[model samples]
Target: MSLENNKIFASVLTAGILLMASGFAAKSLYHPKDLEENAFKIEVSDSGVEVASAGAEEPSIEPISALLATADVAAGESGFKKCASCHTIESGGSNKVGPALWDIVGRGRAAVDGFSYSDALQGMSSEAWDYEALNEFLAKPKDYAPGTKMGFAGLKKVEDRANLIAYMRMQSDSPAALPQ
Candidate 1:
Protein backbone atom coordinates (compact mmCIF):
# COMPACT_ATOMS: atom_id res chain seq x y z
CA MET A 1 0.00 0.00 0.00
CA SER A 2 2.81 2.45 0.84
CA LEU A 3 4.60 1.51 -2.39
CA GLU A 4 1.39 2.20 -4.38
CA ASN A 5 0.92 5.65 -2.64
CA ASN A 6 4.56 6.52 -3.39
CA LYS A 7 3.98 5.75 -7.09
CA ILE A 8 0.86 8.00 -7.22
CA PHE A 9 2.71 10.91 -5.61
CA ALA A 10 5.67 10.49 -7.99
CA SER A 11 3.27 10.51 -10.99
CA VAL A 12 1.53 13.69 -9.81
CA LEU A 13 4.88 15.44 -9.26
CA THR A 14 6.10 14.41 -12.72
CA ALA A 15 2.87 15.68 -14.35
CA GLY A 16 3.14 19.06 -12.64
CA ILE A 17 6.80 19.40 -13.71
CA LEU A 18 5.87 18.53 -17.31
CA LEU A 19 3.03 21.05 -17.32
CA MET A 20 5.30 23.84 -16.06
CA ALA A 21 8.02 22.93 -18.58
CA SER A 22 5.44 22.96 -21.41
CA GLY A 23 4.24 26.43 -20.41
CA PHE A 24 7.82 27.76 -20.49
CA ALA A 25 8.45 26.09 -23.84
CA ALA A 26 5.25 27.55 -25.33
CA LYS A 27 6.09 31.07 -24.13
CA SER A 28 9.63 30.89 -25.58
CA LEU A 29 8.25 29.66 -28.91
CA TYR A 30 5.65 32.49 -29.09
CA HIS A 31 7.21 35.94 -28.67
CA PRO A 32 4.59 38.74 -28.76
CA LYS A 33 5.76 42.06 -30.23
CA ASP A 34 4.92 45.23 -28.32
CA LEU A 35 2.54 47.60 -30.13
CA GLU A 36 4.17 50.87 -31.21
CA GLU A 37 0.98 52.81 -30.41
CA ASN A 38 -2.19 51.85 -28.59
CA ALA A 39 -5.17 51.27 -30.86
CA PHE A 40 -7.18 53.34 -28.39
CA LYS A 41 -5.56 55.54 -25.77
CA ILE A 42 -7.33 56.85 -22.70
CA GLU A 43 -6.03 59.38 -20.20
CA VAL A 44 -7.00 59.89 -16.58
CA SER A 45 -7.65 63.44 -15.39
CA ASP A 46 -6.77 64.84 -11.99
CA SER A 47 -10.39 64.20 -10.99
CA GLY A 48 -9.91 60.52 -11.99
CA VAL A 49 -12.24 60.82 -14.96
CA GLU A 50 -11.15 58.81 -18.00
CA VAL A 51 -10.78 61.15 -20.99
CA ALA A 52 -10.23 60.19 -24.59
CA SER A 53 -6.81 61.04 -25.98
CA ALA A 54 -6.74 64.46 -27.66
CA GLY A 55 -5.87 62.87 -31.01
CA ALA A 56 -9.01 60.72 -30.97
CA GLU A 57 -11.57 62.19 -33.35
CA GLU A 58 -15.09 62.24 -31.97
CA PRO A 59 -17.73 61.17 -34.49
CA SER A 60 -19.42 64.18 -36.11
CA ILE A 61 -22.89 64.69 -34.67
CA GLU A 62 -25.58 65.77 -37.10
CA PRO A 63 -27.52 68.90 -36.15
CA ILE A 64 -30.78 68.14 -34.32
CA SER A 65 -32.58 70.82 -36.40
CA ALA A 66 -32.16 68.74 -39.54
CA LEU A 67 -33.24 65.55 -37.80
CA LEU A 68 -36.28 67.06 -36.00
CA ALA A 69 -38.07 67.82 -39.28
CA THR A 70 -38.76 64.16 -40.01
CA ALA A 71 -38.22 62.80 -36.50
CA ASP A 72 -40.80 60.24 -35.36
CA VAL A 73 -42.66 61.66 -32.38
CA ALA A 74 -44.04 58.22 -31.57
CA ALA A 75 -40.56 56.79 -31.51
CA GLY A 76 -39.47 59.74 -29.41
CA GLU A 77 -42.28 58.99 -27.00
CA SER A 78 -41.06 55.43 -26.83
CA GLY A 79 -37.59 56.72 -26.06
CA PHE A 80 -39.02 58.93 -23.34
CA LYS A 81 -39.75 55.70 -21.47
CA LYS A 82 -36.11 55.79 -20.45
CA CYS A 83 -36.63 59.19 -18.82
CA ALA A 84 -40.01 58.30 -17.30
CA SER A 85 -38.29 56.86 -14.25
CA CYS A 86 -36.95 60.30 -13.37
CA HIS A 87 -39.44 62.69 -14.96
CA THR A 88 -43.11 63.20 -15.70
CA ILE A 89 -44.17 64.62 -19.07
CA GLU A 90 -47.84 65.22 -18.31
CA SER A 91 -48.88 68.81 -17.74
CA GLY A 92 -48.83 69.71 -14.00
CA GLY A 93 -47.08 66.40 -13.31
CA SER A 94 -45.17 66.42 -10.07
CA ASN A 95 -41.37 66.15 -9.95
CA LYS A 96 -39.78 62.74 -9.49
CA VAL A 97 -36.06 61.93 -9.21
CA GLY A 98 -35.74 64.57 -11.89
CA PRO A 99 -38.02 67.58 -12.16
CA ALA A 100 -41.15 67.32 -14.23
CA LEU A 101 -40.16 67.66 -17.90
CA TRP A 102 -43.46 69.25 -18.92
CA ASP A 103 -42.81 71.88 -21.60
CA ILE A 104 -39.07 71.36 -21.05
CA VAL A 105 -38.34 72.41 -24.62
CA GLY A 106 -37.33 76.09 -24.68
CA ARG A 107 -37.78 76.26 -20.91
CA GLY A 108 -35.08 78.03 -18.93
CA ARG A 109 -32.46 75.82 -17.35
CA ALA A 110 -33.23 74.85 -13.74
CA ALA A 111 -36.70 76.37 -14.25
CA VAL A 112 -38.62 73.61 -12.49
CA ASP A 113 -39.96 74.80 -9.17
CA GLY A 114 -39.23 73.04 -5.84
CA PHE A 115 -36.56 70.72 -7.28
CA SER A 116 -32.96 71.14 -6.18
CA TYR A 117 -30.75 71.56 -9.25
CA SER A 118 -27.01 71.14 -9.19
CA ASP A 119 -24.84 74.26 -9.21
CA ALA A 120 -23.67 73.30 -12.72
CA LEU A 121 -27.22 73.52 -14.13
CA GLN A 122 -28.09 76.56 -12.00
CA GLY A 123 -25.15 78.40 -13.55
CA MET A 124 -26.71 77.85 -16.98
CA SER A 125 -29.92 79.60 -15.91
CA SER A 126 -29.38 82.22 -18.60
CA GLU A 127 -29.68 79.61 -21.35
CA ALA A 128 -32.97 78.09 -22.41
CA TRP A 129 -33.19 74.41 -23.36
CA ASP A 130 -33.10 75.05 -27.09
CA TYR A 131 -33.07 72.14 -29.54
CA GLU A 132 -29.35 72.47 -30.23
CA ALA A 133 -28.49 72.79 -26.57
CA LEU A 134 -30.74 69.83 -25.84
CA ASN A 135 -29.02 67.90 -28.62
CA GLU A 136 -25.58 68.43 -27.09
CA PHE A 137 -26.83 67.83 -23.59
CA LEU A 138 -28.56 64.59 -24.54
CA ALA A 139 -25.45 63.40 -26.32
CA LYS A 140 -23.52 63.38 -23.03
CA PRO A 141 -24.91 65.01 -19.87
CA LYS A 142 -21.55 64.97 -18.06
CA ASP A 143 -19.73 66.48 -21.04
CA TYR A 144 -22.44 69.11 -21.53
CA ALA A 145 -22.40 70.15 -17.89
CA PRO A 146 -19.65 68.80 -15.70
CA GLY A 147 -20.61 68.30 -12.05
CA THR A 148 -24.25 67.92 -13.09
CA LYS A 149 -26.24 65.62 -10.83
CA MET A 150 -27.88 63.94 -13.83
CA GLY A 151 -26.50 60.41 -14.03
CA PHE A 152 -27.81 59.52 -17.47
CA ALA A 153 -24.93 58.59 -19.77
CA GLY A 154 -26.89 60.12 -22.68
CA LEU A 155 -28.18 58.86 -26.02
CA LYS A 156 -25.34 58.26 -28.45
CA LYS A 157 -27.51 58.29 -31.56
CA VAL A 158 -28.37 61.76 -32.89
CA GLU A 159 -31.61 60.38 -34.31
CA ASP A 160 -32.69 59.13 -30.88
CA ARG A 161 -31.96 62.53 -29.37
CA ALA A 162 -33.94 64.23 -32.16
CA ASN A 163 -36.90 61.91 -31.67
CA LEU A 164 -36.90 62.44 -27.89
CA ILE A 165 -36.73 66.21 -28.39
CA ALA A 166 -39.60 66.11 -30.86
CA TYR A 167 -41.66 64.17 -28.34
CA MET A 168 -40.69 66.70 -25.66
CA ARG A 169 -41.83 69.53 -27.95
CA MET A 170 -45.26 67.89 -28.23
CA GLN A 171 -45.57 67.72 -24.43
CA SER A 172 -46.03 71.49 -24.33
CA ASP A 173 -49.42 73.18 -24.85
CA SER A 174 -47.84 75.15 -27.71
CA PRO A 175 -44.98 73.20 -29.18
CA ALA A 176 -42.01 75.28 -30.20
CA ALA A 177 -41.68 75.81 -33.96
CA LEU A 178 -39.22 73.50 -35.62
CA PRO A 179 -35.99 75.14 -36.76
CA GLN A 180 -35.68 75.93 -40.47
Candidate 2:
Protein backbone atom coordinates (compact mmCIF):
# COMPACT_ATOMS: atom_id res chain seq x y z
CA MET A 1 0.00 0.00 0.00
CA SER A 2 2.87 2.42 0.79
CA LEU A 3 4.58 1.52 -2.52
CA GLU A 4 1.40 2.27 -4.48
CA ASN A 5 1.04 5.70 -2.74
CA ASN A 6 4.68 6.59 -3.63
CA LYS A 7 4.11 5.64 -7.28
CA ILE A 8 0.97 7.85 -7.38
CA PHE A 9 2.84 10.87 -5.90
CA ALA A 10 5.69 10.45 -8.37
CA SER A 11 3.28 10.34 -11.30
CA VAL A 12 1.55 13.53 -10.15
CA LEU A 13 4.93 15.31 -9.64
CA THR A 14 6.08 14.32 -13.16
CA ALA A 15 2.86 15.52 -14.72
CA GLY A 16 3.10 18.89 -12.95
CA ILE A 17 6.75 19.34 -14.05
CA LEU A 18 5.92 18.48 -17.68
CA LEU A 19 2.97 20.96 -17.65
CA MET A 20 5.19 23.83 -16.31
CA ALA A 21 7.93 23.05 -18.84
CA SER A 22 5.42 23.10 -21.70
CA GLY A 23 4.00 26.42 -20.50
CA PHE A 24 7.51 27.97 -20.47
CA ALA A 25 8.25 26.61 -23.92
CA ALA A 26 4.98 28.03 -25.30
CA LYS A 27 5.65 31.49 -23.82
CA SER A 28 9.20 31.58 -25.23
CA LEU A 29 7.98 30.58 -28.70
CA TYR A 30 5.46 33.48 -28.87
CA HIS A 31 6.64 37.05 -28.13
CA PRO A 32 3.38 38.96 -27.78
CA LYS A 33 3.48 42.74 -28.33
CA ASP A 34 0.90 45.28 -27.20
CA LEU A 35 -0.82 47.23 -29.95
CA GLU A 36 -0.03 50.94 -30.31
CA GLU A 37 -3.74 51.75 -30.43
CA ASN A 38 -7.03 49.94 -30.18
CA ALA A 39 -7.61 47.75 -33.24
CA PHE A 40 -11.25 48.87 -33.29
CA LYS A 41 -13.45 51.24 -31.32
CA ILE A 42 -17.11 51.16 -30.32
CA GLU A 43 -19.13 54.23 -29.35
CA VAL A 44 -22.55 53.99 -27.78
CA SER A 45 -25.08 56.79 -27.38
CA ASP A 46 -27.23 57.48 -24.30
CA SER A 47 -29.87 55.18 -25.75
CA GLY A 48 -27.37 52.31 -26.04
CA VAL A 49 -27.30 52.37 -29.82
CA GLU A 50 -23.90 51.83 -31.47
CA VAL A 51 -22.95 55.22 -32.91
CA ALA A 52 -19.50 55.24 -34.50
CA SER A 53 -16.49 53.26 -35.70
CA ALA A 54 -12.77 53.67 -34.93
CA GLY A 55 -12.22 56.07 -37.84
CA ALA A 56 -15.41 58.12 -37.43
CA GLU A 57 -15.07 61.84 -36.64
CA GLU A 58 -16.40 62.83 -33.20
CA PRO A 59 -19.99 64.01 -33.40
CA SER A 60 -20.17 67.80 -33.13
CA ILE A 61 -21.76 69.04 -29.93
CA GLU A 62 -24.86 71.19 -30.33
CA PRO A 63 -24.25 74.72 -29.12
CA ILE A 64 -26.29 75.75 -26.05
CA SER A 65 -27.07 79.27 -27.33
CA ALA A 66 -30.44 78.36 -28.81
CA LEU A 67 -31.42 76.32 -25.78
CA LEU A 68 -30.50 78.93 -23.17
CA ALA A 69 -32.98 81.57 -24.32
CA THR A 70 -35.93 79.51 -23.13
CA ALA A 71 -34.16 77.23 -20.67
CA ASP A 72 -36.23 76.48 -17.58
CA VAL A 73 -34.69 78.14 -14.54
CA ALA A 74 -36.76 75.87 -12.25
CA ALA A 75 -35.37 72.84 -13.99
CA GLY A 76 -31.91 74.37 -13.74
CA GLU A 77 -32.40 74.83 -9.99
CA SER A 78 -33.23 71.16 -9.76
CA GLY A 79 -30.17 70.31 -11.87
CA PHE A 80 -27.97 72.42 -9.61
CA LYS A 81 -28.67 69.87 -6.89
CA LYS A 82 -26.04 67.72 -8.54
CA CYS A 83 -23.48 70.49 -8.13
CA ALA A 84 -24.55 71.57 -4.63
CA SER A 85 -22.50 68.88 -2.91
CA CYS A 86 -19.25 70.44 -4.11
CA HIS A 87 -20.31 74.02 -4.74
CA THR A 88 -22.50 76.71 -3.20
CA ILE A 89 -24.52 79.04 -5.45
CA GLU A 90 -25.50 81.78 -3.00
CA SER A 91 -23.67 85.11 -2.73
CA GLY A 92 -20.82 85.05 -0.16
CA GLY A 93 -21.25 81.31 0.18
CA SER A 94 -18.08 79.70 1.51
CA ASN A 95 -16.18 77.21 -0.56
CA LYS A 96 -16.93 73.57 0.07
CA VAL A 97 -15.20 70.70 -1.76
CA GLY A 98 -15.13 73.15 -4.66
CA PRO A 99 -15.00 76.94 -4.68
CA ALA A 100 -18.27 78.84 -4.29
CA LEU A 101 -19.82 79.26 -7.73
CA TRP A 102 -21.58 82.59 -7.20
CA ASP A 103 -21.20 84.69 -10.37
CA ILE A 104 -19.12 81.99 -12.02
CA VAL A 105 -20.18 82.98 -15.50
CA GLY A 106 -17.73 85.50 -16.97
CA ARG A 107 -15.43 85.04 -13.94
CA GLY A 108 -11.80 84.50 -14.80
CA ARG A 109 -10.66 80.90 -14.79
CA ALA A 110 -9.09 79.75 -11.52
CA ALA A 111 -9.89 83.11 -9.98
CA VAL A 112 -11.30 81.84 -6.69
CA ASP A 113 -9.37 83.00 -3.66
CA GLY A 114 -8.23 80.60 -0.88
CA PHE A 115 -8.80 77.54 -3.09
CA SER A 116 -5.75 75.82 -4.53
CA TYR A 117 -6.47 75.02 -8.16
CA SER A 118 -4.78 72.34 -10.21
CA ASP A 119 -1.90 73.34 -12.50
CA ALA A 120 -4.12 72.72 -15.51
CA LEU A 121 -6.74 75.27 -14.35
CA GLN A 122 -4.12 77.73 -13.10
CA GLY A 123 -2.47 77.66 -16.50
CA MET A 124 -5.78 78.73 -18.06
CA SER A 125 -6.04 81.88 -15.94
CA SER A 126 -6.01 83.90 -19.10
CA GLU A 127 -9.42 82.47 -20.02
CA ALA A 128 -12.76 83.41 -18.50
CA TRP A 129 -15.82 81.28 -17.83
CA ASP A 130 -17.79 82.46 -20.83
CA TYR A 131 -20.89 80.64 -22.02
CA GLU A 132 -19.05 78.61 -24.62
CA ALA A 133 -16.25 77.78 -22.21
CA LEU A 134 -18.74 76.74 -19.57
CA ASN A 135 -20.60 74.68 -22.14
CA GLU A 136 -17.46 72.80 -23.11
CA PHE A 137 -16.15 72.36 -19.57
CA LEU A 138 -19.51 71.25 -18.19
CA ALA A 139 -19.80 68.70 -20.98
CA LYS A 140 -16.55 66.99 -19.98
CA PRO A 141 -14.40 68.45 -17.21
CA LYS A 142 -11.38 66.24 -18.01
CA ASP A 143 -11.52 66.96 -21.73
CA TYR A 144 -11.76 70.74 -21.20
CA ALA A 145 -9.07 70.90 -18.52
CA PRO A 146 -7.06 67.71 -18.69
CA GLY A 147 -5.64 67.77 -15.17
CA THR A 148 -8.49 69.46 -13.31
CA LYS A 149 -9.36 68.10 -9.86
CA MET A 150 -13.13 68.39 -10.38
CA GLY A 151 -14.26 64.76 -10.37
CA PHE A 152 -17.76 65.34 -11.68
CA ALA A 153 -18.20 63.31 -14.90
CA GLY A 154 -20.16 66.27 -16.34
CA LEU A 155 -23.69 66.78 -17.67
CA LYS A 156 -24.14 65.13 -21.05
CA LYS A 157 -27.47 66.68 -22.11
CA VAL A 158 -27.12 70.10 -23.76
CA GLU A 159 -30.50 71.25 -22.46
CA ASP A 160 -29.52 70.24 -18.94
CA ARG A 161 -26.33 72.28 -19.24
CA ALA A 162 -28.23 75.25 -20.64
CA ASN A 163 -30.67 75.11 -17.77
CA LEU A 164 -27.88 74.84 -15.21
CA ILE A 165 -25.99 77.76 -16.73
CA ALA A 166 -29.16 79.80 -16.86
CA TYR A 167 -29.72 79.02 -13.19
CA MET A 168 -26.15 80.01 -12.41
CA ARG A 169 -26.62 83.23 -14.35
CA MET A 170 -29.47 84.11 -12.02
CA GLN A 171 -27.22 83.66 -8.97
CA SER A 172 -25.08 86.65 -9.92
CA ASP A 173 -25.72 90.27 -8.91
CA SER A 174 -25.80 91.06 -12.60
CA PRO A 175 -26.28 88.03 -14.77
CA ALA A 176 -24.72 88.28 -18.19
CA ALA A 177 -27.15 88.54 -21.08
CA LEU A 178 -28.03 85.29 -22.78
CA PRO A 179 -26.17 84.56 -26.03
CA GLN A 180 -27.65 85.99 -29.24
RMSD (CA, Å), each prediction = 5.8, 7.0
The residue ranges of model 1 lying beyond 4 angstroms of the native Cα positions read 1-60
Give lDDT tens digits, candidate 2, residues 1-180.
699999999999999999999999999999999999889966789979897766989866678888889999999999999999999999999989998999999999999999889999999999999888899899999988988999999999999999999999999999998888
Q: Which regions of candidate 2 deviate over 4 angstroms?
A: 1-8, 20-55
Q: Quote each prediction's TM-score.
A: 0.70, 0.75
Model 1 residue pairs with clashes: none
Question: lDDT (CA) for every model shown?
Answer: 0.94, 0.92
lDDT of 2 at 27: 97
Total clashes in model 1, counting residue pairs 3 or more apart in sequence or in different chains: 0
